[model samples]
Target: MEECCRLGLAKSIGVSNYSCAKLSTLLQNATILPAVNRVELNVAWQQQKLIEFCKDKGIHVCAFSPLGAYGFHWGTNAVMDSPILKDIATAKDKTVAQVALRWVREQGAFPIVRSLNKERMRQNLQIFDWELTDEEVRRIRQIPQQRACTWKEVVSPDGQYKSLEELWDGEI
Candidate 1:
């Protein structure tokens, strides 16, 4: 896919949920670097190390579940429920979701969010117009970090990822 993208057969190429180790291995042999990496990233589950690694590699990080995937079976509403985010949103006169998305955008990652309601979708799109302040960004960085979307079922003694640690390359 990377080669095809480079050859103009495709517009772009990317990977999803890839760890630093996997990306390094791909980089070792790839003829063309990946254009993007889509992953679960949010205030509560910020993939800081992965973001930095991708940035250094010239790979754009596309954030999935930037608001923490609330209400999903495998997700929690940690980012949405965060008091610090709430405060920031209130101070900025924006929604919590908007605040969260803005933070990801400030980190140079593209946020991929979903909202079924027309008004809600419009609200999500408003993130581009405004920006989060440096102090707000600093406060957001202080929020407790936790991986909310760990795919534990994929890791087993008989599976390719023998342990959860191996699945994330100790990133969890």
Candidate 2:
């Protein structure tokens, strides 16, 4: 796909759910670098190391579940429901989702939010107008980090990933 993109058959090429190790392997061999890496990123599950590595390599980190996908089986509302985030939202007069999305932007990544309601969609779009304060950012960074979207079904002793440690390449 990277070759195809370079050959003008596609506009660009990227990967989804790739770990740092996987990305490193691909980078070591590819002639055309990946343009983006779509991953499950949020305040609770902030892949900081991966983010920094991708930034250094010029690969845009596209966050797929910036709001934490609370309804999903493997997802959690940790990002939106955290007391710290709630306090920040109240202080800034923004919604929890807005604060979460803004945090992603503050980390220099693009957030992909999903909303079916018109008002909620508008709320999601409101993140661009405001920024999180330095203190707020520091508080967010202090929140206990946790990976909320671990692909557990595929991570078993007999499965392809074998274990969570292997799946995340020990990053988790």
Candidate 3:
């Protein structure tokens, strides 16, 4: 963290996949708050409270995988299979991917979405041209909270956090 501040390479440095406790430590040791904290955020796995906490600290929350990556079958789950998102898509006459992307943008966080397909690339960018209703956004936020990616196998068994919940201060 000090190296980032010293080199001046990053205007502001933050962490991705850092637990709340780790963030607290960083904050305690640092002179400047992080400008952004990127995380796996989406309609199904909306980290609402965490996002709010970051916003309260003036740390911008950036969402990755805005469009449920259907490419990864292991990562796909029922939350991504929600009919609610499909309903919104039907009502808006837009693709489910578009509705998902729009929902993230409406939440006041920058969503990092990528697609190799030309049509999908165009569709994702079209979110800015349209908007979801406040009610729609609320409904999207109601999605059952779940994590699509986890580092359970990666963390050492002797580590303090046995699960992501412990890592996130039991927010899970």
Best by lDDT: 1
- Residue pairs of candidate 2 with colliding backbone atoms: none
True-structure Cα RMSD, model 3: 2.1
- In candidate 1, position 139 carries an lDDT of 91
What candidate 2 gets wrong by more than 4 Å, as runs, is none
Clashing pairs in 1: none
CA lDDT of each prediction against the hidden true structure: 0.90, 0.89, 0.76
**In terms of TM-score, how similar is model 1 to the real structure?**
0.94
lDDT of 1 by residue, 9-119 (tens): 999778999999999999999888889999998898788889999999999999998999999988878899999999999998999999999899988899998888999
lDDT of 2 by residue, 145-167 (tens): 88887877787787788888999
Q: Estimate each model's TM-score.
A: 0.94, 0.94, 0.87
Rank the models by lDDT, top first: 1, 2, 3
Q: Residue by residue across 1-172, what tens digits does model 3's lDDT show?
A: 6577779876768679655666778889888788888888888788877777787788887887776565575355544477889888899998888888778777788888777789889887888888898888878878777677675665565887666666666755
Query: What's model 1's lDDT at 120?
Result: 85
The runs of at least 3 residues in candidate 1 whose Cα sits more than 4 Å from the true structure, single-residue gaps closed, are 6-8
